[model samples]
Target: MPASDDVVSHRAGLLRAPDGEALPQRVVASWQRSADYGVDLETVEPVFSGTPVTDSLFAECGQEVLSGLHRTLENEPISLMLTDADGLVLGRLSGDTSLLRALDAVHLAPGFAFSEREAGTNGLGLALADRVPSVVRAEEHYSLSLCTYTCAAVPVLDPVSGRLEGAVNITTWSRSNSDLLLALAQSAASNTSALMLARSQGRRPRPAPRGEVVRVESARLEPGSGTAHELGEAWSDAVGRAAHALAAGRVVAAVGEAGSGRATLLAQALRRARPHDRILSAAAPPPADVETWLALWAPEVGKPHTGVIVRDVDVLPAWSAPALRSLLVGRPSGAGPVGGAVVGLGGGRPGGTTAGDHPASGAGWAVTAESANALPAELAPLVDVVVEVAPLRDRVEDVMRLAEHVAHRARGRAIEFTPTARRALESCPWPGNVEQLVRAVRHAVSRTNVVDVAHLPAEVLSGSSRALTRIEAFERDEIVRCLTRPGATMKDAAAELGMSRATVYRKLGYYDLQVLRD
Candidate 1:
């Protein structure tokens, strides 16, 4: 465990004996278990006869992560490992062909089992066994063949189930910097988990020939490649930060325009952070007392981390606003956060309209809802923190990704978007945000074989600047120009506009510009 490679290697070797005091107690126990399992330190690389249970979304997403990590590993003597819950090496990506060939000689490829029970004391194996991020260097590995390597690994948990799915690991020569190795592993694992969570939430790409591939995209996607998972980078980051606060029992305030998925984000994060707690969902109402609201869960619900979610605080009455605000924002600095309540103040209405009348206590954390980017002074005092749930227009890549994800769920097959379809989608403002996208995709899927321009809702296409033909806009513009010019005569305008007087009159009439035509 010493910082020096030589010292750490010596310690690892010492751990091989019964009297080794250098290893952590848990690690020593793992080594003893490995020995009891009759592990062969010389040549124990277990190969699987069939596919692993992790071959589903977890494996797909893991491969996607490893493939992205290859950019860092390209032509280097390093390998990124994607192992299943059982510690099987389900996917491997490395740009160093020579190094990959060397690993293959040792059976460290796909379908190989490198579990703690199988490979013994390796980073990926121990990470799975211990359900924690880990690092293992030269000689730490119980297998002698792996003594020349250093590995850093972090477990990938199912976003919904919150169970071990697999691990993302970086493996390199023992000389590699352990800090950087662990950092990269943690980052990759987090990205993979976020993507996997999206896929689990019915956001799968159209099933590919091989099935749902959840690769983290590092660049703009090439033509014909579908984006697998997205909610925008900012939203994903916000979710992580908010979830972290929730884990520490902080009251989270989620602010977004109506239909932007503020409630969904809060709910999912709550479930993830406190899986055992009961979720008491409610729309903002004129509650008589804040204490009664907090303790309203059914008796059958058994958990210490239970909390309430005020779905739309914008709807709360003026009488209740002060009480709710005091409950969330009026506590003293030493007071505890709301019993884990995550209040989402809905947007669009004047700030004074929702949770406005409460006197500021300057004590607790509050979530300020910014529906129209306006933090009303009345409700402003209610927030200690503000998290914006970005609307769909701001994240167009996520639009296409979501469209494909929803389309697949509706159609039960893989479907690609046409360039025009994608363009139209990107241009739309998505006034209803995610809710609108869902309805629109469901509508398109129900009626069409493919999601094309024609299949898209007329309203969405109308909102898309590119959806209109050049000629259509040009004609409309020309008619408006000639008709609206100061004191312009229709007769002169028609001649210059290249239309007969009668045709110009008719066109103006058709466009409801008769008032201007005269």
Candidate 2:
């Protein structure tokens, strides 16, 4: 019997037997019997409804079940009907026109009770009564209005407590029948119940924090997901190792040479990490939630700055110390300061003066010879960390080799660089100093291109000589280029040309570069 509070006044002509006989008496008798069984009949005025036992638990479970059901249907005309433990229709998913009409004929939408006592007998009602799976087809329903539909339903059991939580039923027109369909519905219901139980029992495992590991190679930054390349098995193995470390929660940082599969590795790592984890490349930063930052050190000092603006420091390696010191002291060998702050990266003492030693008086700050040298040092005292390029002997030699190769290939012809020239092309300390020599030889062999030294840009051929060659003209051109680029750096340009950054001061001394130096 329903609880007294669960009783409701029957809608005037809502119920009819299979013979079209009115069942008002039977409905009233059923309500009375439900009251006798401790069911609240009085609450039936609005219908028997109660809040879920836990916050959003029932709703979340329902949603999970519906998701699987939707996938199973896959655009097929299938309808899902959810009934409470008491066999009341709580929700329905259907797109079948005929099924909808049949359901409407019996007023069996949400809020309709299909309990054994109320609906006499049906898959939903009988299943609720017996607490088991059931199927009711045409002519099996005690109610005349429901005799045209077929439904396969199963009682959903809470895995942890082993209680009948609810029931899921798939309904269709009476004409449709397939054992496969029935089995699918039962499987979906079982899986949904398992999920609900797991959630209820708090059995879901918490995902571990991902490791902070990033590897980026010489791949050009792409607009989305960065650049991608095929990695050989060796690289792939390394990436897999990195991924395993990440999964185990380790901090790993890798420096990939250009042409390596660094970008692809990074992309894969990002994809594998939890949504909260981040993968940052030059082109993109991880989501805000991830505690990560990217440091970009350009080879050129005067090129326009992109991405985050960290502290700008002049990096002067030991090899270029004399030239750097000379430039700082105003002795220029033809090249002028490109513009921007120059932070001496490796020459400062371990605990030298802080970046704030001079206390930059303006928005931009420059790390003079007094600032720290290593990454930790520069990062320690500066608000925004930026690395300035300084040519080392190895680097200079490399650049010279590359330059000679380029010159030899041109054979003295006036050659035009497609993108003018790159800072790295101009200043990179070719670690494999003579690598470009081989490339040049190959290029000359393949294309029969004549090597031109004179046509080469003054910056590439003469290095600092270009700055001192025509100090005024160079300054004007540099200023115009900086203004055009919007965020050009003088220090960067100086480093690229293998010249002392102090030359910028001498050049600026002659002509205003219209740049705000910090």
Candidate 3:
């Protein structure tokens, strides 16, 4: 049954539902989150973020999807909207004058932030919040002012990387019958992601004329088993593959998303092959300094026993590629040294052997990129092998291990995280990858002794949809152990942990655990 306005008001006034009635669990969670965000229930005064959506890939693709959907519903009293991942409205399309006025009156037009943090619990906000399809109708909305409308929304993710890009939202009058709103929103969101993926796959990066270069300091050995063998099978497999390539003196490229430690993986492989190898790491330079940058690093490439790793070679300028290619593999077919005094030679070989004469010859060469296909066209032909580093999200088993490693190194002691805290860390999509995880762990350790869920940053608690981690399993086990004790009641178990009965019930549902009761 639909909740009445009076019931919603009563529930909003107190954090509890009216007698003989129950609110949706998701709605309850959103209400708690909205209250945490300090949203005003009496009005929906969304803040204007003033962020433009021009030329944004998400906005572009989303607009195309929404436009087609809008045409199908042009005569209907509906508004189709697109918002960035942050819930800042990017575009809104509606032919119905009444719906437009209503949306405008609530500041739901473009440039306004209707995120849960800004406009309380609504369809788009909840979809973005949970990275799922959501529906909020009439009195189910947290804000009283939104009680006159129904909204359904679905989060759009990057098809290639599974990163949250934005959302597709559909809004209509509260009295309207729109059972298919959620399905429509889901289809639109999927189409947007598919378009983005297609465009990304079809686009080829063109190298420009200029670029800059800077030498990177020695790689910091990460905490715990910085050695590849111990991190997990994924890391081990990548390092092993790169090591094989380096051992044969093949030009290798470590390809994966940024912050997935591609360069580090290559460096570790190189070190494994030649313990005393001197590795020179350089960030692909800016356009203006391509020539000088080439000149500066050309000598190091020719030095014996030295390995060279160019980070993000995918960004190398078009003009720089031929020169760099020449430096790494000698002069291009007919051309003389591409850069001044930058002749390609058999340098960096062990035992002073000519690199051309043997398989295990020449200075070790490697590069890093977001993907192998993203590398510059000029250098692509020279790459003999490509090693892929899996992102941290795919390496769930390594998250807790890595977190403990980071916390241990930072605090100089083993810091334990509560199971709930571990669940938060493990479930995060980790868009920033390992680098973000390190920062989050450091942030938690700096503030608290034993890391609890409360100590985790806000970002860690949201935007994740992965299955339960080992830590969450532990949490579930503890809950079952507590609940199954002889002659125990749910209230007693909640009291034992100093948790409210409501929280226990929420966790039970979250874990999909059923209580055996008399």
Candidate 4:
């Protein structure tokens, strides 16, 4: 044989050495003398506690260590394994199973001991015996079954005290480079140990809070009267404390009326706290036609008007039916109004009192006052006297028809616009009733070249469809054009105009147009 082939033969011979003469035996013998002092399987097994580690610990460790190992060995023909101190396999990232089984049959499996005196001489045994890192190639293991496997293992130590924490191992076929594998395993073990140590020492910072309160202003006064300055100061202090808490890693949610000065309070709190923290206020104005008393406290409060109808009270059925349909469609409708009834709209005493009877009547405020005697505290303030309207079932068919029409149009055009249109058509308060649908359709047709739900303007998307009637007029004009064309067979008219022949016939029938010449 040539010199290069001889060297390969010699290495193969070395790997195939008998169990007693294997290199793993020598390494394990030496390691057993040092770290194994007063420690044997009998004494160690009972002391090995199996406490479950926290998920956060695992997640952090995986992020810091496992991710790196995955990236480094992604294309390499190697299998990396990490085991806990008790020899329980924690995780494994492998290249191939045939190679893994070959490694395993040689006592190179994770969680299996290959100490010289025990199972006898393997990379794992030698590394444990030496209390360091070592590599064992084919014939390097004392066990006969492990002759075809090559493995490298390193003991990870706790960074603070240098105590053995766990072991990291890399296993490959005997053809692999043993020296390189051992080096990589040792490096990975070291890095993992450092990460664990840093985590134990609280080196990692906590996640930032979700939100903060910038400012809060409130005042204490009689139940029916205005708030005082002291209350505002107290509210501001509360907001500041909340913001501070958020900065210190706490989630915070705020709720109040439109004019409750909630935004100002949140803003002030943010100014005093960390700039990185976010502050949010949920104080949306009431829908039109509903007088909002809360808007009075808003920094930008405007005169309460009756022209604006608060859909919250007026469009109960419109909202409910779509929600019910959505639920039936397997999509979540979220939480609907409690007790499955519209909140009544009235103030002071509940019984049939007009707006003129209320104390805030001159203030032009509409308060959705809860019936304190009948409702839960959280829901009480939302209860205004019931606004009568048609039942949900009466209008649901129309909304559904419109939604279906828009969806069909979207699909035919191969446009991804159904969701927005569907949502608008389904959710909007159709105050002008069916007439509104006609105008909205026309507006959508004109404004959109390719109708997509997302392209619709926000207000129109969320508004009533009273404008769709304009679209109907356009449809009518197209129908007239199709019918007046020369040799306008119903089939030709339907095909050219994108309408059903039956629909064209029905239109002709309605207009008393004779199709067959007598």
> Which is the leading candidate under TM-score?
3
lDDT minimum window of 10 residues, candidate 1:
207-216
Global fold similarity of model 2 (TM-score): 0.30
Writing each residue's lDDT as its tens digit, candidate 2 over 166-239 gives 77777776677735546756886777775664554232222222322222222233211422223234444445
Give the TM-score of each candidate: 0.37, 0.30, 0.47, 0.30
Q: Write down the lDDT of every candidate, Cα atoms only.
A: 0.60, 0.42, 0.71, 0.42
Candidate 2 achieves a global lDDT of 0.42
Residue-wise lDDT of candidate 4 within 1-518, one digit each (tens)? 11232333344355533334543334433323312222231111212224434254333453357567868677777877775543444556776777667655443453454343344445665565445577777655444455566879886655533334456778777788888998888778767765664554222222212221111222121121121213323454555554453333222222222123333333443434444322222222212211232233222222221101111111111112222222212233333222322232222332222222221111111211112232222223333332222322234544645433544454454323355455555555644343344445545555555555433323333222222233443454466556545567768878988879877766554433332211
- Kindly report which residue stretches of model 1 are placed more than 4 angstroms away from their true locations once superposed: 1-21, 51-55, 202-518
The CA lDDT at 34 in model 4 is 19
lDDT of 2 at 68: 64
Q: For candidate 4, give the lDDT.
A: 0.42
- Stretches of candidate 3 off by over 4 Å are 1-229, 332-361, 464-518
Candidate 4 deviant stretches above 4 angstroms = 1-25, 28-64, 103-118, 202-518
Q: Taking the tens digit of each residue's C-alpha lDDT, what string does model 1 give over 265-314?
A: 76556555655544544543222233344334223122234444555454
Q: Residue 324: error of model 3 in Å?
A: 1.4
